[model samples]
Target chain A: MNIWLLIVGVGLVSLCLRASFLVLLRGRQLPERVTSSLGLVPAAVLAALIAPELLYSSVTGTLDVLNPRLVIGLLAAAVAWRTRNVLWTLMVGLGLLLVAQGLGWR
Target chain B: MRHPEDMTEIIPHSPQFRPAFWRGMRAFTPLVPGVVPFSMVAGIAAVQAGFTPAESIAFSLIGYAGSAQLIASQMVTSHAPTVLIVLSSLIVNLRFAMYSASLLPLFVGVPLPRRWLLAYGLTDQAYAVTMGRPVTEPSPAAYYAGAAALMWLTWQSGTAVGALVGAKIPSTWPLDFAVPLSFIALLVPVLQRRPQVFAAIVSAVVAVAAHGLPFRLNLILGAVCGVAVGQLMQRWQAKSV
Candidate 1:
């Protein structure tokens, strides 16, 4: 398949997924249980997305317990927990990573 | 009764809309720095996957999803089967469906065309920012539009700029790690309740454990398990209290 076709196909899939509930279930109320569960979707999915990135080495594609990303990520999480500030969390996380690299820790 | 179309006209002009809209923009502004580099990584990755700048822009616009864009570009580079490419990318994006569901009630009376626009702009940032508002906030649709608009602009431009110049950036910079760090910042704020905290923990554990799943199924599995565990915890907490 052509690259454009492939891009459109993937795009359509994304659009469909995003539009599924908003368009399909318009004017209808969801059950409370489902709505409540959906409330957790943000937390659950974001965590799911973040976990593997932190634990697994991007370069090696393997689980590394001592991955610097994991360590810095945890520190970032603590900063986020404390500061509730995006810029601070990012600065601390990236700054620590740069420091670690500078020290030849990899 | 207000016609839905009338709502489209009035909503944006309503007294509540402008402030809420600007508030949404302001709320999302802090994350822009993080979003740009992450998007640049997506753009850089697309270029590395042998796409022209134009093709990369088209891919970014079409996909409009950061991680999915990364995955799709990777799959395309590997010449993976088209079906597999779409499936894997869609798997990575399945969370959007849940986001849409969560947002359904908020847009109940919104017009069809506007709903389409809202859905098109559905994203982690928009959802988190809009839903993170206090329960009694006015002009939710407007707030959503505001947040979504900023996110859309930031993402599109970031991706375009990245595709154009991201190739020059050295790989040694660890810019890719910024993606997760930004997410961690966003994720931490949303986790307020015990159930939400447990949900995040459970999902992370499951995702890491199920990391072997094909086509990024581990994410979906982790989210599902997390939601279930969260629901049970909610009931448990309620009963205990």
Candidate 2:
């Protein structure tokens, strides 16, 4: 239960996972299908993280359309689609959220 | 095969240290804006969550992943058991395992010691840039080192600044939006194919459905489900083609 122990344990597990393929597939070429499938990891994981944050107000909590975070997040998504730039998308989302707040939308 | 000594000697050096460093900096240029706000917010959150400046900097340097650090800090604040916190954090970061696997092929020929460094430096930004790159003569170690080092330095500095100045910055600014915005931007570019889109949509839905699950187990489940679906879709497409 010690925090240091926990950190060390997690760190070791992460390292092992990271090193798994390197050790197992050392001299072998991964099949093309397997290689292509690895691309799913990021999108899958990111969506998993982002979804609840945008859709729900709290953990295990009710969905609230009035949630400012969700509204602002949608604005951010729109910006991401339009500009396709992280910096610009962030700026526009933040700008819109602040504007909405100033207009008493929050 | 040629001698290892000869190979090392033959590898061309950059023209100068200044340019090499500048090139490294330029490689990081694309990521600065994204890294800055996220790190700054992380810094401020660390302080607000009661971490000392030194601790905040240490987390930025060592923890590396902003989301994981944030989750860990939240657990700490709520007095969650250490094991639970670490377990959840591990689950959240499990995707890095896949990333490292995908990149291992690229780093195969690099020396053991340098490869170790790249392993430590493997990050979201570094992985994003390096994947799909077609270098006529790939030096994965050097490229990864350049990108990771720059990201590490920038993230640490930004966290420090944010911890120092974030309190003075007003809450009126929508700084919180930056993190999600950053992810959205990263997401759009990667959604170029049907399988990826399918995976993303399914993952989002599963995550939302499983959001209430205890110990953040839903994240792991959602990720696995998504990967399975994407792989199935990939197989189907391949067969049809």
Candidate 3:
């Protein structure tokens, strides 16, 4: 599988998914169950994506609670929760990570 | 709750498309700086995986997805099979379908071609920004196009810069962590109720516990289970209330 081909395939797959409802449904009413399920998509999917990044060690590929990522990510989560601001969450999160690394805490 | 400074009244009420576009762009400006670093990390990862600068930039253009691009780059470096890479990347992106479904009501009157284009440009940030606006908003397609235009430009430029100068970035900078941090910011506002919170918790736990599963099955499993839990919780809350 050539990388370029892979890219194209992935692009097409993504476009199809993104277009699935918008194109196919065409303003038609989705089933109520699906509409409700769609509402949870962001929370559920984002949490699934974020969890491994925060908990799993990047290098060792195992659950490590004390990893700098976990500590700093939790702090970042707090910032996000408190401020409800993307800029603040990112700045504080990355800032904490950089500082932890600077202090050789990893 | 229209803003006092809203100029909609002064203009002839023909659905102010241009203003909505600009409003979308302005609303998304704060997140632009944050997006650059996350995109840069994607570019750097691609280059580090032996993709040429041009190829890395191509990946950004063709894929146009942040997390999936990053995962694909890693899988490529590890010599993972192309099928697995594609499968995993698609799994990561399945949430976009949900976004498409949820946003369909807003685009009902939009033309077919424009809706297709809008769908192509759908990203988490742009979707979130557009959805954050008042549901009664006019010119939503214009607004989405505006935010997505800015987002696309920012991502392409940042990836270009990262790929061109990726080797110089110190490993200690922790640039990759910025991706998850940004996600946290996006996730927090969505967890406004118990059902959503419960969904997130269930999703995270399931994903983590299934970490050893191959081909990114865990993520799909986690998301499905989470949505199911959330649905049940919503019904239970309604019954109780």
Candidate 4:
């Protein structure tokens, strides 16, 4: 699969998904349940990606809290929960990690 | 409750291009403060992964998704086959399909050319903001256009800056964590109910459990499982009520 081919293929598939309802539901009302379920997609997918990276050092590998990346992520999550601000979360989490590294904590 | 006519009257008349464009720019302001650091990391990653400035900018503009671009760069560095690299990037971006589907209801009446532009401009940030709004009239396309254009410009500019200046930024600055933190920032605001919470928990568990699956299939599997769990829970709740 050429990279360009892949991009074009994925782009088409993505466009299809986006355009499906518009094509299918033209001149019709979407069922309420179906419409509501689409709402779950983002939160579900983001959690799937975020959880493992934040909680574990590696998939199918031993847990390692000592990993500086893991510590940094945990701190980021905490800041995110507290402040709910993107910049602040990044700054605080990354700041702590760098400081910890400076002190040779890892 | 007010009738549909009343609701229609409540919508302010759609603004012209100047106001719409400025509104789009204003929507992007919150994102500006965060992009410099994030794109700098992306830029350095692309450069270290052997991408030229043009290629890096192209990925930022065309690929559009930061994480996907980073992963693609990594795959490129590792000599992964073109198919595998593209498939992996596509898998990561599968979520966008869902975003587009959810937003389609709001923009059904917009013209095709406008829809094409909005599709090109769609980003996670833009979708987050757009989906959170109650559906308003006078063209949901305008609101989406405003938000998406702003995010697109900011993202491209940030990538350009990163490609130019990323090398000067020290690794000691803790930029690596910014990417995940950005997701966290996006995540917190969207966790609106029990079903969403359950979906997140299930997705996380499935992601961990299925992590060893080949081609990062775990992500796809986990997302499906999470969505299923959420839908099931919603159904059960409806029955109970």
- TM-score rank order: 3, 2, 1, 4
Alpha-carbon lDDT, every model:
0.80, 0.67, 0.80, 0.65
Question: What residue pairs are clashing in model 4?
Answer: none
Model 2 agreement with the true structure over A31-80: per-residue lDDT tens digits: 77666766787788677767776777632458776777788787778777
Top-DockQ candidate index: 3
lDDT of 1 by residue, B49-157 (tens): 7788898898888889887777666556657667777776676677788788878778757777778888999998888889887677767787788889999999899
Per-residue lDDT tens digits for candidate 2, residues B1-241, read 2225323411236333344334544666777777777778778766665677767776666566766666666556656666777776666566676777777656555555445555666667776666634464345445556677888788889889978876666765656556566667767777889988899889888988887677666666787788789999989998999
Scored against the true structure, residue B198 in model 1 reaches a CA lDDT of: 96
Query: Model 1 misses residue A23 by how many Å?
Result: 3.0
Residues B1-241, candidate 3: write the lDDT tens digits.
2234344322323457778888889878987976887778778888877788998898888889887887777668667778888886776787788888888766655656666778888998898899887777667767787788899999999999989988777766777776688678778888999989999999999999998887666777898889899999998988899
Poorest 10 consecutive residues by lDDT, candidate 1 chain A: A25-34
- What lDDT does model 2 reach? 0.67
Off by over 4 Å in 1: A1-6, A57-62, A85-87, B1-34, B48-51, B70-110, B127-147
* Candidate 3 segments exceeding 4 Å error: A58-60, B1-20, B77-79, B132-138
lDDT by residue for model 1 (A15-41), tens = 998998888765567677766876687
Top candidate on TM-score is 3
lDDT at position A100, candidate 3: 83
The sequence of per-residue lDDT tens digits that candidate 3 reaches over residues A1-106 is 3988888988988889899888865556767777677778778878887898888887688899989899889888888788777677878888887788788777
Worst 10 residues of 3 chain B by lDDT: B1-10
Candidate 2 vs 4: which has more TM-score = 2
